[model samples]
Target: MEELIKRVEELEKNTQKSSRERELLLNRICELEDLVEDLTLQLKKSKKTIRTPVAPKESLAINNASKKTNAQEDEPWLFYCPKNKPYEEILRNLDFSEGYEITSSALVSEEALWTQILEKMNEEEIPKKLTALRKLVSVQLSSACHHELLIIVRGIPGNENPLFQLILPHIATLAEYVNIAWSEVENSNPELLGRIALVLECEQDLKVLSVDRGDTRLSLYVEKLL
Candidate 1:
């Protein structure tokens, strides 16, 4: 009976030892699973960081495209004119540097000349004749006529002369080449002042009327009358 009881105790001890070993193995598996899950989360975070650089590059490309579009839109429209010879041809024909000065006295003479013409037409009695001068200007846009127009402007006190204001735009339209001596005329008269104001107002409607003030270079530019 003692020997049988001892054998039963030994079997119980062996069974208890097997249960403890199985429990330990399960705990180890659970810990390993937790470690694998942590590594997977870290790997996902790394991939996200790597993708971050691509977003800024795309943003930069969009900005550049927008800037180019704005630049194109901001460009100004060119003046419309009838077809004429190239600008270079005009440039080759004129000499701006010499004989450009119109003395104040000469300018006075020009003003007097217009005064006489206006008086002869009885401009006060017929104000519409003054209006007709604008039409006459359009009819005579030739080089000789352009010279006469310039002479008319040179003498008139642009600020004082209503006639100058009326005629200055037509003059600008016909000016193929222009050279003004600042020494001879620097805001000297109201008529010149009026002409300058007209130039600014009509800039959009006129071609680039380059002015060479106080310089000695004569270049031809074509002024087309439409």
Candidate 2:
């Protein structure tokens, strides 16, 4: 009976030890699976971070070049018309109208004279010639006597009076066709339409007018209105 009892106790001890070992192995397997899942999640996040896009250096360079080109194209000139000279002399002596011809000049053409006048208005220094240029534009508009005038106005850098207020009433009058020749203009060339629109917009008035771009014969009439 004593021997049988001792044998039964030994068997129970052996069974308990095996169960403990199995439990330890199962815990270790669970820990390893958790580590693998964490590692996979970290790898996926790293790949996503790496895949994010960055702007190319060449694209940045191209954008900068485009801005520079636009700046150069919009560069403004200075006005230099004097009151003491003949209309032809004022047109000729001014640096802005150096090569421009008055006889063949259209009312609204982008000739040297017109460019000079616009440059003067756009200059940073606000030269004394601005007054003369303004008068010139006003006189030209008055002489052409077109009912509907379109003016394109662009502000000059560093200018306090950048708005096209100086030519507003005249432009407005032209738009209404109150004093100018509306019939002849309607029958004339259409190419002057764009220039006329620009002039009208430049004035910055809240008025609307129609211009035809197809007529080339009215260019002379448009020039006179300029």
The clash numbers for all candidates, in the given order, read: 13, 29
* Poorest stretch of ten by lDDT in candidate 2: 60-69
lDDT accuracy of residue 174 in candidate 2: 33
- Global Cα lDDT for candidate 1: 0.32
Q: What would the TM-scores of all predictions be? A: 0.21, 0.21
Task: List, residue by residue over 1-226, the lDDT tens digit for candidate 2.
Answer: 9999999999988887875675455456556766898999998888745555764433111111111111233211112121222434433332222222221112233233344443433432222332333434444444332322323332211213433333333333333331233223324532231112222112222223223323311111121111
Candidate 1, residue 148: how far the Cα is off, in Å: 99
Best by lDDT: 2
What lDDT score belongs to each candidate, Candidate 1 first?
Answer: 0.32, 0.33
* Candidate 1 local Cα displacement, residue 44, angstroms: 1.2
**Which ranges in model 2 have alpha carbons more than 4 Å from their true place?**
49-226
Q: Candidate 1 at 210: error in angstroms?
A: 84
**What would the per-residue lDDT of candidate 1 be over residues 1-226, giving only the tens digit for each residue?**
9999999999988887875674455456556766898999998888745433332221111111111111233211112232232333322332111111121222233233333434433343211232233332222222222222222122323335565454443343323222232111222331232111011112123333332323322222223322
Error of 1 at 172 (Å): 93
Instruction: Give Cα distance to truth, residue 153, candidate 2, Å.
Output: 86
